[model samples]
Target: MDTSKATGNNAPRNLTKGEATRRRILDAARKVFSENPYHAASVRMVGKAGGFDHPIIHYYFPKKAGLFECVMEEHVVEFRTFMEHWFDGLDAYTTDKGLAVFIERIIAFHIANKDLFRTLMQNTAHVENFDQFPASAQYEVFHDSFLKTFRKKVHHNASDEEVSKFVYSFTVLAANYLGASSTYARFLGMEGECDAYWDWVKETIHYLFLPRMEKIIFDSESK
Candidate 1:
């Protein structure tokens, strides 16, 4: 399946020569951290991956911790944009438009940038446990935004306590479904195929969320 255009999916661009080099270094660091454990990733390795002579990461970033922090910052911005789009798109999800767009966006992201997605979502534990985690602040911001938006969405259906329950349940279900793709691929039957998976995600969102949301809002308004 189209391996082309795959290599640079995680890379960030748009910079002057100096800024370009710095961006490349950050991309390299993200690549390395996603493949191996973040604790095991090295600045020298990241620098070399970006076609540098030596530990030039030190030149661009003072310490490995700082470099990792930059990587985390980049991811935080990405999450912000993604969440913004997700929220905006909700307005577009209508009786006519359907949930296909929303499902496709999430599934496409999961497949295209699996490593980046995994690193950001999976490394929550690492950030939580580290005493002096460099990326903690960045994650906290995104986490807050996610919860705020999530709470708003759920409160449209349930009480405060119920909204909290739905938030936790919804997030857990989304995470489990997205994260288990590798396993799901093997035995998901027909829906495991990428195209079919998109269909499946659409159906899940429609069946699990939209019916209840419509009942609570649209159905109420109509009544």
Candidate 2:
């Protein structure tokens, strides 16, 4: 019998040397790709950042596109796990509180994964054939998972289109705001005051978007 299909071995295991090396290369690639557009980034740049020879990087990811795809898929998986846990927590909350929790946790996530977010945004804009990329499927999974969680926890009565609009609007607002953190901080005269900048982000969301979101969620519930 094939025991490989069993869940008994699902316990955490340490990375092998090769796995560790690959992780290092992916990390370096993520940082490099985050800083530069895909066209401007190179495997050599990733090698320098990761302290590996370019050939080693090639061995792990023969094509730069493949490396980018791995990086995106890794980030998407991380985000999906986060969303699942986050939605689990929201199950016990009222919609108003759920919205607040959603905003707060999402901001924290954006701040934590800012680099991945930047890479995704930059490459998405520059990659003319993004729809054809293998990573695009991972993005679709992430999107579907997100919408599923949102519907399950926040608005069960909402249509996918309605939920998508809410999700899209919130993501656009949050991503652009957090992605340009420095510029937003400087423009607001809160430069060097990171706490103040984040606080302002929360305030801005509450004042600008939260009420409309609450209305929508409640409207969906009432319907």
> Which tens-of-lDDT digit does each residue in 1-223 have in candidate 2?
1111111222235989998889889889889977888889999999999987889998889999899889888777677766665654564666666666666776677666777567666656666786876577776776677767777766445566877887777766776677667777899988643878877887787677656665666565434
Name the best candidate (by TM-score).
2
TM-scores of all models? 0.70, 0.82
lDDT of 1 at 151: 59
lDDT at 89, model 2? 58
Q: Please provide, for model 1 over 62-171, each residue's C-alpha lDDT reduced to its tens digit, 9 standing for 90 to 100.
A: 88888877887876666556655554445545632434454455566556656555565556545557657767787576556667776554225446565555455555
* Number of the predicted model whose lDDT against the real structure is largest: 2
List pairs with backbone clashes in candidate 2. none
Pairs with backbone N, CA or C atoms under 3 Å apart (clashes), candidate 1: none
